[model samples]
Target: MSTTTEARSGFSPRVALQKVGTSLSNMVMPNIPALIAWGIITAFFIEDGFTPVPALGGFEDAAGNPHLGIVDPTIHYLLPLLIANTGGRMIYEARGAVVGVVATMGVIAGSDELVTMLNLTQPSDEQIGQIHMFIGAMIMAPLAAWLMKKLDQLWQERIPAGFEMLVNLFSAGIFSFLMALIGFYGLAPIVNGLMNLLGAGVEGLISLGLLPLVSLLIEPAKVFFLNNAINHGVLTPLGLTEASQNGKSVLFLLEANPGPGFGILLAYSFFGRGAARASAPGAALIQFVGGIHEIYFPYVLMKPALILAAVGGGMTGVFLNVLFDTGLRAPAAPGSIIAIFGNATTDSYLGIALAVIGATVVSFLIAALLLRIGKQEEGDIAAATAKMEEMKGKKSSVAGALTGAGAGAAGAASAADDSGHTGRIEKIVFACDAGMGSSAMGATVLRKKVRAAGFDDVEVTNKAISSLSDEWDVVVTQKELTDRARQRTGSAVQVSVDQFMNSPRYDEVVELVQQRNDPEAAEEGTGSEAAASTAAGAGVGVGTGAGAEPSADEGPGSATAPEILSPESIVLAGSATDSASGIDEAGALLVAAGAVDEGYVEAMHDREATVSTFMGNGLAIPHGTNEAKSSITRSAMSFVRYPEDIDWNGNPTRFVIGIAGVGDEHLELLQKVAMAFSDPAQVERLEQATTTDEIRAILGDEKESDA
Candidate 1:
């Protein structure tokens, strides 16, 4: 939510960028359906030649030849209505929707209305009033919605019970009518004038050989998750106009080019690691053939500077469009090469291909340089393959490829985590960016799995990320949008997965739920030989290997040991009854006491599962792996003392001290801790201490001897 408490905390460049990017993405998300649907209609319903299908009441032309007969109203009516509804819905719900349509109609009104209403004659010399289509709808819809929203606020909760229906109906109708009048009389001329000015500026920029400069903003916007917004809300309308006038418009080629993404994935093929390498070819097939350009977004996000590759790629595509006059007749829904070629003009196909190739090559080279592909080692290849296996079925393909590959080093495969645990799970919800298309499909796949596993009592539903709640047992979202889901549901466990359609993790989730209904199952299944013990170092300050200081010299702050732990940081607890609750409490306590970042808790659990933190002598030290260093705000230690030992991965641990060390910065602390806990009797003495001063006396003695 706030770039992870483990990441930059406050006003940093990184956090600032996230806010800006998220804000832009939200603005255009709701309107995406209208944009894509309109583009689809234009792409297929319209004609390329006169000798088109004659199925719909085709009439012979002056030459007595059959031609296309069906009327295509995509641009004239459907697009304006769809855009108007989208804009209105952005401000309010159904009321805003009605106002938006009415306002759009109002904006398109002209003096010709007088001719119909009052029988006035129109002057032949005067040009008919031209309706502002896309731009006008966008403006008027929001304006109308705002006015309606204000009216609704006035009617807030005061209406009599029986009069509620009457008031609601009348309020919406009157507000819509009033807003429509405002749109016609006040906003129309001003909005239309601004639209024309913008059009002129764009046209001038294109003619002056500055069109490629557009990518500077467009590419960044795309990275901000506004690719859909820019493509649909702004560019598609402009392209529609150009297509009407010139049969095709280069404007469509600017943001919708798949070349840059294609190029990045191609580079990953050569330079990327395990999952990344294995997933690249499949992603390429989907990106190029299936037209889902979203598959490549995660790759770019891995390195934000990689956006330059997109900019360079987009600019090159636009450059070729200018040089060769290439443009598609409609927006490319999937932004795939196949779609682009399908929608392009016959004469421009070769030019479009060349432009795409140029973008791909340029981006690939840039991405390769950025990735430093040659540096990856062969040992990681097997690990990556295993991660890829976690993603099962077409969910990987249907959702987007390259998800598991990018998080190659995450290493989520842990005995404790991979194995099911005992926890009640009544609800399972699949979430996504929009939480409709992909998530719904994912929920269906998971639901089938749940049923097949004979767990039909479990509820599985899909909803948008914004609608996610803490009441749900497990909330799953796509890898890229996991932060958004986390922000919404802090208490609920959030699963970061690549695809919603299908994943091997679904079975694990179901198994966990089953184990929850029968907690004994988890214990029975997990019964195994005691894990290989760590060094059974003696009491708090008794015996230690005389040569142990050599290993200490190689630890944190090597060649320089510093006093890192303090008595004031320790907290003595009566006992820990439950391992699960205790671990969570310990992690949260560290965060609350300002000892570590919020992300450290999750990372520490991950690290604990990967490698047992139990260091014997009734002690278990939990610390995140070096990879989790970013989650550490500063180097600090949190000591939670349990009088009665608790089960720590089957080992009894009396102390669960969490260390938030930056990389290997906690070496000095570890050495001091080792010396303090060296004697078995010293640990016993400290455990019996009732106060901080008493505990300090024991530690103080060890410090005195070390000095």
Candidate 2:
């Protein structure tokens, strides 16, 4: 709701790097379950971990000691296939995964020993190549997948009608075979060399004392959601190769170190006030223990200076990691204290714990210094409030929410005159640089709005802007990403909304879609048509959208629109006052009747403190926030009319509507409230009425309350 411009307004190489990292991160995310399972198998059953569960076969060693059999094939061959196929799916879709896995076999078997049916132990170790192949698979999977995608495109363009199946099947088989050969002959050697070179580079850095410098790129990238890609695509494979030789590799500790995030959250927990302070404990727990380091992204985003804190923490951790020469048997999946311990070597445990603790402490100190917690949060609130009031209804000046960036693109698109052109939109896709963190959240918000507004069939989804396709009906993205998304989506309706978190324009999208899907709703003043929601204070009604047309005023308990307001009870206004939260006369009545709790009244006040609830002319609807909904036992509605107007968020309120919704039922009820509020005549009539029954007629309510 703040009017400040976002820090992501411009682009730079760092931004692009972060995007690549995010792309790799999101691409590898679906494979996490597999990776975790593989890591656990390696850690527990492969004889490298504390409680070594035997996998292959246990036998006596040369010294008559028990030698636990290790499942070398599972880690060397199967894990690489799973990793490669996963990366493949991200690049070329499902078919890419099949090709990538198939081709990876070449890397696994290319220089390896072969058995002869005619002879025993015919192939010697000298004739065999035993490259771990994680690096090889990583390089070749994307290559094979890209070729498959290109071939699929070619087949689509040129394949003949009945021969399609035969040609497609044959082409895929040939390509898979060729890719395998190519992986063995071309990509595997190159990838193997590159892995060694990178591994050597790490060793060189450690020797030269430059290993800690990795944090310079890492901390900022982690802030941008590159945590997964940097860990899985770049680091994990390298660690596997080193771990194969040394029983563990410090490479595993590099990306999975949860220190920076933990540090940042720790700072917030101590220095932050208000909601930031309240949320920090949970966030810290998740970041450090749950291993979801992304939990602190917003904290850094809020104060960019905190990135330095993260950097300091990351560097400190890396320094300690190198100093101790510590490593893990497998990648710590969650990077949680538990996961790290689970994968830890006996020698590496102290180092890992120390590194994480050191980083956490460093990050906390830096973030606390940067947070400027001593500054009064609301010292400027009074001034800002005055400025806000002067600019009320002129919300377009605000940068990212409904009025700012979201308004420009969506407002233009949803304009009445632009309606004819946008009528074809059937599905909407939100695209972002990284996709999930911003674009996915944006898509979820819009989708909920779409469903709330009664357009269920309109598909809503998110993808990396790199994945935007021309087939999409519409593409939604932040202003900075719109041009890129437009170029990729190609003539698809592209809309730019600022701040993917909260778009004021999603309502516009819902309206446009409603009109497109239910043409009758567009007709103004239709007797049986639902009205599309505009910005806040939009009229709500029941008609062709979800509920039935307003039934003939049946006097209060009628099921005119069950999906609309399920009115539970109504009480006329009683002794209400001003200056506090609301004229609680209405709230007390509802609470007295058990329709809602006293908490509902307090919730209404809390909402009012942030913004006024007064509808224009003479009405106010009060309800707890989404977070406050836990106070309500069920979905219900109640109303209390005031004899005199009480100040409601600046506007006078004679009618107080109390709503408690379970699930999205409140959203359905909101439509009717909007309709009644938007009409000056109805509001005027309600103000003149002295009884709840008269108020019911004004609200298009036909029946008595269920109570």
Candidate 3:
């Protein structure tokens, strides 16, 4: 099966449905509070007799011609639109409130033009109100967005964990105060000035005429990125106003635009000869009738320069609307030929036809130019495609292995016998720097070799080297982790696999395992048993009946052994050490080990000048991960001491600087290092050690301590 099909198959239908439901809910949910606020306002207007249409449905007498009623019709028609526009803007433009709020206000004013056309309210007064609302909205949206972000950050950090719900409730209260501030102090003057300015034609030109100019000036490559920002940042918020004005929620505009289907069609069009020729026909059908503008997005994205052309076309269309003094009463819904009829003037058809023709021409010309200038190489495309496919395959294989392992574990548990014993072998864990790539492959090969040699009692697993310890019966790893693994597992056998550095020999490994498990079977009816016994009688320790010196080079006393230290001794020792020098020394050691870069030591020293690195206890793990220019492979430890007192975490530190070289793979080591420090006996010995050699001896000790 193709990779795409496999990826799709991995996601359950229920999960896909849940994602859809969540997206829909998020888009619509913000309007609920706005609806409640508007409802209260509407009810107040009705009771005050300011409403033109009564709540219970009755027009007041013309003789009484209530002033309240005159204002009521305008309020009733415009308030809902204002709330929706504001709320919708908030939802879509999550990060930038200023743009969203202004766009929403614009949407409300734009949509209110529809009410004027319908004769629900007088045009002059409504137009003035529209201008006021637009200006007010523009100012408030950004302020609200900023306030929301600040409150969110404050709640996440300062509030206690369990009081999250209370914090959310408090945020709402704060938002209400902000809203009130805007209504009383912020909105009034801005609205009044905007109404006055909008009276002149300059406002129209500034708002609409500049669009085409801006589009032309922007670099073609950057236009689509800007377009995405504008749609989410500006247009979505505008939809809110439409929803609020008509008492019809238009939140779906945020989701429906620039449809995914169009993108798919455009991508296929690049390879499909027939599809490219029919592109305009398909776009016209979907965009004009179905009102799906996204049907063209794929085409635009395929050649990004076309996006600039589209922007140019859009700006031109907006400018023409201004020139013709045209206004949309409602947001042009189902954005197509038929929908335009609802809002179109005598010049509307001509405006739209010009927009489509101009946009198409720009897009086509730019695409053709780009294609002609730089045709893609077939070899490069094929290579990239192959690499992508390989990565996809590896991911699939790993996922399948994990799934199979989980299922096997479950089955084993369920199939236990009456003796409460399942026929499952114990897991043998092998670890290194990064878990489960090379190590995992090695484990698989080792497991096969072991099983073939009839050692089926164990099942092999691989993990990060840092996790190797008492977790497994026998820990297997490369030479680098030999010292660390031995420190963690005192008596537990550790097999350092040289096969990692060299090519693996499966047959030799199988034979070795067999020999280790059954010495008597191999020695049967042979004089070699006598020779082995003779060797054993000698002062030599044999591994697999092979005569070899246990201490090959050094004397028995020279073997590194573990040391136990008391917590009090550790503290006292640390008190005598110079803390600053200790940290510097530790940094220097790491640099020498090639685990960290040189300047890193200096940076750490500089950081230390400002604050102490001693987190707590007698432990001072001083290190720098960011100093290295390239990726780190393993962590390195450096032991240091001061002859005199040094201030640690408010305590005098004598023994200091436990450097940990942390890389992507070495995180596990940090945990083990932490465990080592936790032991009071180890801490005492670490502090008491006078020389670097003494410290290394104590650390290298494999024996268990009673402290």
Candidate maximizing TM-score: 2
For residues 1-707, what per-residue lDDT tens digits would candidate 2 score against the true structure? 12111111223444345545545554455555665565555655555554666645234667878654544666677777877877677678677888888898887666342212212444555332245776666677888899888878875858775887888778778898998887767676676666667778888988999988989877876665455556766787778777765668888888788998888888877777665566677778877787866557656655668899999999999999888878887777767888888778778888888999899889888888877653425122122222321122111111122111332233234542242321334678977553422344456546555655666667888776766655466677766667787666543556667544335666666666655455455545452222333322232332233322233253335453442333346656545656253437656655765657788778767755643444334555555654566777765666766678776645556666666656544443344444455445556666676655565665655443541
TM-score of each: 0.49, 0.51, 0.32
Local distance difference test, each candidate = 0.59, 0.61, 0.40
Question: On residues 1-707, what C-alpha lDDT tens digit does candidate 3 reach at each position?
Answer: 43333333444343343333333333333443443344334333443323424533223566966344422344333443344344434443433333334344443444355334545555655543233243344345545555666667775668886997887667655564555445544454455444444334333534554534444422231222232333333333343343234332222222222222232233334532333424545554565467655335434444444454454444444444435444332334445545544433333446444544444444444444544464432222222222321221211111112112221111111111111111122455656554522354345445544553445655666776654544244456654555666565432335555433122333333333333334334336354433333332222232131112222112123221111111111222332345556666666556566556766666556545533445333455444423332433335555555556566646555555444344323332233233234334545766666544444434432222321
Arranged by TM-score with the best first, the candidates are 2, 1, 3
Better of 1 and 2 by lDDT: 2
Q: Which model is ahead, 2 or 3, in terms of TM-score? A: 2
lDDT for 319 in candidate 3 is: 46
Candidate 3 segments exceeding 4 Å error: 1-127, 130-175, 187-225, 228-275, 278-284, 294-327, 342-707
